[model samples]
Target: MSYKLIPPGKRRNRHYWLRGTIAGERVEVSTGCETRQAAQAWAADYVARLEGQRVPGIGEVVAFERAAELYKAAHPHLSKSDIRLVGAVAKYFRNKGKACHEVVHADLVAAADELKPGRAASTKNRKVIGPAAAVLHYAANNQWCTYQRIEKFWVSRKSNREPARDEDLAVLIANVEAPPRRKKFGRKADYNVAFKRLLLLMLYELGLRIGHLLTVRWDDVDLRAARLKVRIPKSDEIASLELSPVIVSELANLTSATGVNRPALGRGVDRRGRLFPWTTNRGVHAWLKPLTDRLGIKYTPHMSRHKLATDAQVLPDKKAAELGVWKDPRSLHRYQHVRPEAIPGRSAATLLALPAPDKRKAS
Candidate 1:
């Protein structure tokens, strides 16, 4: 065996350390065993596992920490939030001295309870359960553990956020288009106003998420054809949408105005640069809040998207899903908030028209 098993000492800490090369891959990790005999056995098993010589049912023990490391190595493109979640799960399991194969449903539930405590079920599912399941599943795929399904906590279906009303949106658009009182900033203020107005229009018309809208460049737009090419961030797919005439007109007006006649100094529609001046959603929301507050309407940037989804309920499921860039047509159900009057065959007039019977007999 080319693998070297070093005994516990000043350098090796309490656990036995395995360091050497196997199959041209450098191996350096703790065996998580105290006795020299156990360490030697672990080192041989690990080398055999690495070389694909060992069967799945063999006495091959893999620590949760090691399994997590392997999972991370396999998937290098995980998002920052996903990385944090995986790290948190690995840390908890490492502290517990848990093996990847030994983890059960109870262990996962306990981990969630201990790690997230009083957090919501959805939060725990995202932060703990989901990440831990991913690591364990990856380990199972590699024969380091048996596959175990981890179920997520059931979350409520009720949503607190109401979709923006047509009247409210109209009021917002009118207010943004009206002249800015602050003449000191002059063109800068006008530019900001114009940008907000256009942003609202696109959010309502295109049914795009706020993140997708912020990243759209001028090259993605075709005002002449009244078309827009939006990059869906989640799926990493480009979706082409037919632009509304209102949006095309606004974009044309902004692009045509230049020099002293322009709203701002910089190019209105740079082919390379993003369409909106703001890089982050926080900046857009901060600018929008005061306007919403002044208008006496409770609104958010995402509310525009909800409004689009609600309005699209009249269309077929497939058509509605396409409008929202949803991968599943069923997802439209979650977003659509049908008004009382809009519910098919359930209008107040229809109920009123029904004959009221048996009232005299009861009296």
Candidate 2:
């Protein structure tokens, strides 16, 4: 029963036209009404005239599940994470069997709110609300439903996680155990200690997301040029990062001692050879936890990203964004987690002095 009030073409009827189905036929009739509401009223009357007449074409209703499927099918460019998110949302709504027109803003908000208990605001927005909106927008574009805007969930500027310090990192790397001797004759030893050390340094220096860090291939490293190519999974972009001499030496020695470009760790190596050679991101996280606990410092993979962004804030905005592989300058706020004392300024209390008259008044 949906109808659209279309504006007049240059043919100059100079009136709103009703475009939809009437009596099982697609109709494009001038409503002769100046106001959109009146045109809609006339269209409603037209539909009423088609009551019990088996209107066939534009009156067809689509199920929510079908529309969601269509929406996902339409966007082949969506990243793996985005595809997972959209699929999660689709799974939630698959049982409801609601038509596209029946889905409203309240329904979307309720779905987003359902995620609030388990997820942070940013995650709720990104994983749930964002995908729901995309589906609705797609349906609207096909004229199956009206588009309702969903507001992105707000996140606080403050984060509980602090940055991992370079000093602590250096200490941790220095204290890691040396590799044991190979038992077999003529069998080359794997450098686990050296490998972990280089991994930690690269994590602290490169500021890559954990997924990207875990998947880095040996071929991506260019030691002679002092550069590394990191595949950023979220942005679907490859970032070329400059490497320091310390990072270069660590990588060179680790590769040289193992006598291979692939990580000596057997299970995680692909044909291309990953750098860390950990089977999963969780394995890498678990491996690093013991070292951080021993060093008496809190550490997470993301803290390294925060440390990088915090340190680079001194540079210009564009430069900092480039360093962090950020497309938007505003995204810097998400990565920066500087302590109050670390901010570049004297405190307001120190910068401003009380007037001498205040003492006189007290006396």
TM-score of structure candidate 2: 0.66
**Any idea what lDDT model 1 has?**
0.72
**Residue-wise C-alpha lDDT for candidate 1, range 1-363, written one tens digit per residue:** 367888889987899999888755787999999999998898888887886532234346878877787777778878788888898899999999999988998999999999999999999998899999999888888788778778888986555668876566666766664335555655433546667778887886665789899988878877767778888856668999877656766677664223222222235434457878788999887767777776677888788667666666356777667767877676666643732111121111221233442211111
The C-alpha TM-scores of every prediction are 0.72, 0.66
lDDT (tens digit, per residue) of candidate 2 on 226-255: 788887755678899877767766666564
Weakest 10 consecutive residues of candidate 1 by summed lDDT: 339-348
Q: Candidate 2, overall lDDT?
A: 0.66
Error of 1 at 257 (Å): 11
- Top of the candidates by lDDT: 1
lDDT of each: 0.72, 0.66
Top-TM-score candidate index: 1
lDDT of 1 at 199: 86
After TM-score superposition, what is the CA distance of residue 268 in candidate 2 from its true location, in Å?
Answer: 20
